[model samples]
Target: MEVGSTRSWDELLPDALGLIFKNLPLQELLTVVPTVCKSWGKAVMGPYCWQEIDIEEWSNRSEPGSVERMLRMLIARSNGSIHKLCVSGLQNEPVFSLIAENARSLRILCLPQSNMSDSIVEKIAGSLSMITFLDLSYCYKISARSLEAIGKNCKLLEGLRRNMHPLIMEERLSQDNEEAHAIATTMPNLKRLETAYLRYINTIGALEIIHSCPQLEYLDLRGCWQVKLDGEYLKDKFPKLKVLGPYVVDRYERNNDYEDWSDFSDSLYDYESSDDENRFGELEFRFYQQFNEDATNGWPPSP
Candidate 1:
């Protein structure tokens, strides 16, 4: 403890090193830090550094099997203590099952643009009872059944992002409101719900969600062309609600309203801006970009 005395970096405790390493990118943690020294390697390989795993960036740049391998390795390192897991490019059921079995403490799960289906989600929802935040945006395979299962099981869920790209005109006309109804019926405790660009959710479904979820403070229905929101009514009913969408119905008649109206324009801005808008905006941009990339690149090739 002399003023001139020095300490080696390797002498630092694993807990302290884990805290420092958590800020580094996943690629660096996997490739660079462990190679520095034996003590650093041990620290990086421990559960402390793997508690909140975010491999989205790494997974996006890697091949399908590579992502799965890395996820399995990291999950093993976490040793049943992963708290927040956000990844993309998930292609199979075994990885999902492994997460449900191992990450008992996981609270936040984001798997945007993955190939997750109803059965897999239904099977895993029971084990993810502790999850508070879930993002399944642009996951085309998920439907109302999965939402219902998640709602019944993850009782503590506070935030959900189920954004999707706008469906074509033919598909939108035949699409049902089952997903919105499922959310309203089961997730009464939800405080934040983002369904941006979901083209099928009509006025009835939107009203059902608003009336059922009394605690909802943030709702993003942007690009939902079917929803015709009475802005005055919504403002009076839920004074605290912050909505982002085209709520005002146009008085002018047009033959192709549905086709042209959903486009984002300065005139469509009706909601009050807040900090949550910025946060949700970032998430929307990230997921939308990822969705486009996945579509163009065709990820998770046939097994």
Candidate 2:
């Protein structure tokens, strides 16, 4: 990549640039290519590329407000071409408002590790009729009332990820139970479900998800320490599932021996096209409880 003189949009190749950007991820273009020159910047900020965004951050990146700045620019430049948004961090309300205000076209949204509120989720879910995938991992503050809104409007939804903390001492336990049950009943078309690392889970809650999403194929239940499935009976219910518990892709996990009651061959998925099928891998789950809020912010519980 090199520096070049800026050119006016009248001479811009919007179509060619769109094709180029279609292959580039959001994070890479916003930081590197878009900053190179005004011509490329205008092309990159065009509606076609900005409409559907995928932001991925690697381990060695810094510059606190860079992503925020880019997303804001895209929203302003594209005039709400953004429909399918995939984000990977905590975003404030201003950014959310940018998308929600022009959210009519949004279909799939991935906001893992977001610290979200119920009102915001309701607004987006209520407004976006075409939404299919909604991933909200590490957003521990979500409640059942907001989830109801999602089930109502996002009927065409195919995948949902909502893992938050369970309230043990609340008088709203009954409310929690019924709401959880309603989620299963409402989102019938969901094919993939995921949650964050939970120290424990009620068996009824677990059962509700399995029975509700009868067509479920990919399940990520990692970090759920207290939720145990009957290895024997689960064979019948979970035969189609491939991933279980939490998502741990780097480390190797050993599957625990459990009672086998169903035929695995009858339900296992074949995600690959005949020409592209190569890898067939299975992951196991693991977790721990409690961490210190240290005086100097030190993390404890070392293995």
lDDT of 2 by residue, 2-33 (tens): 47867654465876776677677655776787
Q: Which ranges in model 1 have alpha carbons more than 4 Å from their true place?
A: 1-6, 167-173, 247-284, 287-303
- Per-residue CA lDDT of model 1 for 152-269, tens digit only, reads 9999988888876543222555678999999999999888787876767888999999899998877777667678877788788888776776321211111112112223333223
Model 1 gets an lDDT of: 0.76
Model 2: residues >4 Å from true position, as ranges? 1-13, 25-42, 58-66, 163-179, 246-303
**Top lDDT hit:** 1
**What do the candidate models score in CA lDDT, each in turn?**
0.76, 0.56
Best by TM-score: 1
RMSD (Cα, Å) of model 1? 8.8
